[model samples]
Target: MNKAIKVLAGLLVAQLLVILALQTNKPGTTQVAAQPLISVNLNTVDTLRIDDSDGGQVTLRKEGDRWQITNYGNQPADQNKVAELLQKLSDIEVRWPVASSAAAAERFEVAEGSAQKTLTFQTGDRVIDSLFMGTSPSYRRIHVRANGSDDIYQVELAQHDIPANPESWMDKTVLEFEGDILSVNAGDIAVSRDTNGDETSWKLAGSATDSTDPTLINTWVKRFNSLVVSALVPAQEVEPIIVQNPALTAHLSSDKGDADYAFYTANEKYYVKRFGSSALYEIASYQAKPIVEIEAKKFMLNTSDAEPPQ
Candidate 1:
């Protein structure tokens, strides 16, 4: 009985020792926190480059507080979208590495040259940081590897969140105007609104014999109130489009200022250029139809059809 008791006590001690050893060296129980995958300060970042495996690329540069899509004719970038991307880069914390071996990297698509997407951040000419992202282990979780490290981690960023298309970063509403519209002139179609009145009244350029349809005029004028373009045409590509006689030309005066717009069509695609803007804006056919196809006769009231002005 005494020998059996000692043997049982020895076995219990060995089991306790093994448990303590495992508790000390557990995989993720270290006191030190996991280092961040991306550690560059966003304020110092002035340029961003995104490249995808499919040969698509986009570049954005910071000028003052505004961001511009440098590859897309220096067009203004969507500030909110840029801010969100920067915030995501700064916020991603690496809890644990899903992989670190070279073979593992190749299997996960995060190997040095095998990554699906590469994001590079730069300050002036120096690259501040870069990351290679590939393969979604799950929804919103992307396998990422930092520039100088072999350890690849699955982070909470989606692959589509960083688009390689320049248009995805451009501000589509850059041409949208604000303030009260004062007057509009388009060849024979001219209209002006009363600026100093509680109720706004519009006067057409033609005589009473050529009275205008208020609804049609109002509808045509409102298109400018909140114009949104579908895509941006680079300045180099727009020269031929602009040099030719435009299909339609219109000038507008607002409380804020005055501006002119020229519309054109090439290969069945519609385009518009604001007189002072550096680039041409591509608009949808539906958006251009009502404005470009407008005729003075269409807006003029058919008084002959009226019942003798009863």
Candidate 2:
């Protein structure tokens, strides 16, 4: 009787030990099946590679507050555009088929040793990124590397199915030149002459200035307003002034002159004076000729122009 009791006690102790061992081993299996290896977090990455369908590739890196294309030795990159792409990638939720089934194997190619290329991403101690299974015939694939891993992405080119109206974005404001002429900032001058007896030409000057004169200020303000109110004309309206006599192009100018005008007609070149009461005088192209034309027409009309109101 005693021997039988001892045997029974030993069997019970052995069964308890076996149950504890099983419990401990169960946790390992649950952890292994909990998450996938390829999941990625898009926000913290500082570098990325983007490939297009045409076999072109771009690599970008973050510098200061901007992202630049570092693959070409530090070129500027469009950060806003890149951010939009990253957001799209993180939000994608793929519906992968079940493992081992024919449908799953065919759609995702998840089997080991598959032909498709896989993308990997790592940072410090974490791995994050995405994978591309097949090539998109029309669109190209882009690779992004952040932290320590690589991520693959696909991009498509937009089609021009809709026509765009070029004039839609133009400002329509108009300015009346009848008001006081503001200070004009003249740029470099080019002199030429025409064959005909009459001489006429055009000059370009930076329209911006710091003057506060009521008349000058009002004129520019109106001009800027007109530009905001009017649509720009097509390019066909531009016409070139004719140059005739090279001798007529001689003129004199002061470096400190407030305003400078290049006057040329079909036959002569004149450097006209601007600023002070004497500004109305036109400097003769030849030393023998006296000053001519006081206060020539100060303003010209533009049939087609546009700008924002001041």
Candidate 3:
């Protein structure tokens, strides 16, 4: 009986040990992650050129204290986008080396693929690093190949997050003169400041002032503040495709200068041509709808406020 009890105790001890061993060896519990695929001093990289196999090449240059998107023109590049790209390039380390042979690179999409984009990092004229990036192998991973070598590696990153196109890097704020927009004549509807001072606000002008509803002018101002384009119309295509007469025109005057945004409609989408940019900007529908069809009664001063808030 005592021998039987001893054997049962031995079996229970073995079962406990097995459970402990299984728990210790579980995935991610005892593993160290792999090292980075590529390493570089991000500060040393002053200029970045991304030549996409898809189409246009984007060139970014750090000028003075700001980064300039210098393809079609030298305007400020979106800093958030530029900063994220640099950080990813500096931090990406290899998941595993996929291929060493040049022929093997095509299978991994690091070479001879239409989707491949080459990122060239430079300090002054000296090349810091040049790498070819391909499509994602899986979620949160990208395939890469270094210059002057055939070694390809799959690294952790979303391939689609980085935009290789030149126009995508541009600051989209093409027209931001809403504060300076003294008056606008959209078809027959017009809005303007009734008086000239800091305390003065917008009201219906010419013939729209039938009532005292402030909602109309307030809604127009709200939309005007956020007026920006989907993308910069490319430089080469600017002159040929642009149109003069717009469906709506907003004549704006600022302390700096006089600027205007003329809105044109094609196939139901609203496009705007500003004074400075040769490129026609597609107007966001949320902003365009209110101004295009806003009624005159909307500019009225509130009855409660007009009565002098008792």
Candidate 4:
């Protein structure tokens, strides 16, 4: 009886050990996860190419302080524009797979051979910038690899209302003036002054045949608006000898030519002069003061108050 009991105890001990060993050796219940697909660092990429689905490609290369389109004969690339593209790439956070429905698959082209694009980036060393595969009706999957890390992204061609043409953003009109005050000859004008009390108003002596012409005024206004104001002068210097009165005398001139004019707001009074030997040699000068300055004492106020506000 004693021997049978000892044998039973030995059997129980062996079974417990076996159970513990089997539990320890069995495969883990949780599965190991797959790695990500794309990664990149922008600062290191000196050269890169972005291929479009329409078979167009843009190649970017870093020049001295700027990036250039090397494939387009080394044209200058707007750095801010390229930075926006890089930001978009960096911000890609998701790459969901297309569904398996026939319409979905057809749209995504999953049955078709993978339309993959390989991007090569050259720093000091060459690296695969991105690998895009699989197409969808709305988007495509891009698998990117950079610095040995994986990033997956979904991309789609953005619909554009306007056609993509470089000329659309370029200057189209021939007479398009960009800067302030453009100067042109006004031909000729006769001048005189009307003096009433202490105040005087300068007037053109003849009826301007083209004076009320909208096109002429528009042309002159546009040109004058484009002129850059550099220095201001007193009215007496710019007026014709006959128009220059005892009360005022001064003028303004650009380093370039007399064809130009200056600008001032409507509330400001202006003294203008046309001077030259012939109508063709004419130039204009502009002098401005507050309209209230027509009052003698107010107009005589000097340079002391001209300083910029503190």
Candidate 5:
């Protein structure tokens, strides 16, 4: 009887040890993935629309493989800027949740109707996601709520707001005149230069030019070629503001018969309307005066006798 009891006790002890070993071998636990605030494949994106609180809106469309600023006269969008914007949106991960109450929305600038800015992401006219940008919690982070969710999340992005102005996305290279100019008509005055790419020699139509410094003509052409503008507004937006009687009109004809450039003066300000664009441009009076005041004699050196810049 004693031997049988000992055998049964040993069997029970062995069973318990096996169970403990089995539990120790299966000790791995499940882990949950960190959810991203905004997760959309970039290649699938179609359009990005931005609406501002000040009643301004901009639409950018992804066509083929490139993006275009659709609303601003279908202007070519700045690809580098557009890519940066897309990467920021894609990398947004929820750092933490903020206030979700209705009153908290307005105070935080994430309210459904009163948000400072709203970004609408679409895939072929179908709204995929809408993000309402709110007040910044810090310079490096912002409060944003996506898809009408009551919960406002703090994202890692530092952007205060999405770009709403079409010009903001437009490539600043509006016009790059690279052709060899053959002739120029500055208002009532007309001027012609050597067509063989030598701007040093210039002649006025029906008038004998005084002994003028050849370099002066060359320098003016260089200035005109390198002329940069502070800002350009689409003609459709502020057409009424454009002056009908321009202070100066300069028509440039390149070998390729390229576009013309016109200048206007109004309200003590100078504006330029480049060829091809319906937009009217505003240039500083100080900058525009030098180019607009160009004449046959202006090319003459100020010395007692006109001589080339030595």
Candidate 6:
């Protein structure tokens, strides 16, 4: 019995040792403390270019203090989007390298000339950092390999996050108004605002005071403040469309200045051009409907449409 007890105790010790070893990371384990994939000084980066497998590319450059999409006619870039991308790239950390061999890079589709996407940061002509992104392992994790490095890592960046399309980087809300719009005129339809004591009122042309729906006019003014276009029309298509008669023209008087917007419809797409802007934008039909269909009579309420007194 004493011998049997001793043997049982030895077996228990062996089992405990195995459990401890299994729970602890072994020597030569691939797991490592998280470290930044690329060290980039964002302030020195003035240009960013992205190339895709389909041979499409986009370049964004910093001009003065603002960012512009250089390939897309120097259109102002959405600053927030640009900043977010730079921040994400700077913050990506590598915990474990999936592979470090040249063959593995090609197999993962992160090698040069075979990568699904490549992004480069530059200061003038000098390249700051370049990275290749390829097949995603999961929804938000993609295989990435830095330029001149065979080590490939899986990072939390999807292909759609870094679009190679110039339009995706454009400032879609560039035409939105910044200040209070005091008045608006579109052909025979006119709307203006007035303030008396603590009361504010709106006037619609051809409609008596207090006869028009103030809510409708207020909504229209709000739309002007929050207008966002779908995308800018190509430069080559601008002259042809502008030469044709516009379907509607509206004048907006604001604290900033008076500006005119001409709306056109061609190829079943709605387009709007701010009189002073060189870029023409394509607008959705739903967004253009309120502005283009505005009429003085629409704002005026008929006697039967009035609500009974409380």
* Candidate 6: tens digits of C-alpha lDDT, residues 135-209: 999999999999988889999998998999988999989888767778888877788886331114777877788
Q: Give the C-alpha miss distance for residue 29 in model 3, angstroms.
A: 22
Clash count of each predicted structure: 0, 37, 8, 22, 1, 0
lDDT of 3 by residue, 63-155 (tens): 876788777567678788889887877776654577788777776667744437777888888888777888677888888888767778877
Tens digit of per-residue lDDT, candidate 2, span 32-68: 2322223565557766643322344455666766766
Write candidate 1's Cα lDDT for 42-135 as tens digits.
8899999999989889999999999999888888999999999999888888877877888888888877667899999999889988899889
TM-score of each: 0.81, 0.31, 0.69, 0.36, 0.67, 0.88
What's the distance in Å from true for residue 48, model 4? 2.0
Identify the runs in model 4 with alpha carbons over 4 angstroms from their true place: 1-38, 52-55, 95-118, 137-310
Residue 236, model 2: lDDT of: 35
Q: Order the candidates by TM-score, highest first — what do you get?
A: 6, 1, 3, 5, 4, 2
lDDT of 2: 0.34
> Which model is ahead, 3 or 5, in terms of lDDT?
5
Estimate every model's Cα lDDT from 0 to 1. Answer: 0.83, 0.34, 0.68, 0.38, 0.72, 0.84
Cα lDDT for residue 237, model 3? 54
Error of 4 at 135 (Å): 1.4
131-235, model 5: which lDDT tens digit per residue?
888788787777888775787887766543366887777765555455676777777656678777776677666555565655666666554566655466655
Q: In model 5, what are the clashing residue pairs, if there are any?
A: 235-279
Better of 2 and 6 by lDDT: 6
User: Model 2, clash count?
Assistant: 37
